[model samples]
Target: MTAARRAGGPILVGLPAWVYLPAALGGLFVITPLLAILLRIDWANFVPLITSESSRAALIL
Candidate 1:
């Protein structure tokens, strides 16, 4: 939300902040694999998971 605003995108216009949920979830999905790789976990055992920040943000609502 903050970065989009800085990049000149609209901030919560016709749609409420709810519109960002899917995008945020997609972000989590993308980041999960990257973090697991950085941690050097065995590829075969890796299970992509949402980051703690994403979980907290979702719960706060």
Candidate 2:
């Protein structure tokens, strides 16, 4: 067995602070667009909008 495995400890203890900045930016990049879409939703008419014929066709496609 490897020395690390023999020690019975985690292989990766922690990450550097610099690593977190890019990780956070990547997460925000992906989530921001979805959040913007959700924010712009007309909640009161949401069901009708999704149930519309055009929407159903698009979903089927």
Query: What are the Cα lDDT values of the candidates?
Result: 0.68, 0.86
lDDT of candidate 2 over 1-61, digit per residue (tens): 2223326676644566688899999999999999999999999999999999999999999
What digit string (tens of lDDT, one per residue) describes model 1 on residues 1-61? 3333436666543556887899899999999999988888555544433445666688788
Question: Candidate 1: where are CA atoms >4 Å away?
Answer: 1-15, 41-61
User: TM-score winner among the candidates?
Assistant: 2
Which ten-residue region of model 2 has the weakest summed lDDT? 1-10
- The TM-score, computed over Cα atoms with residue i paired to residue i, of candidate 1 is 0.39
Clashes of each: 0, 0
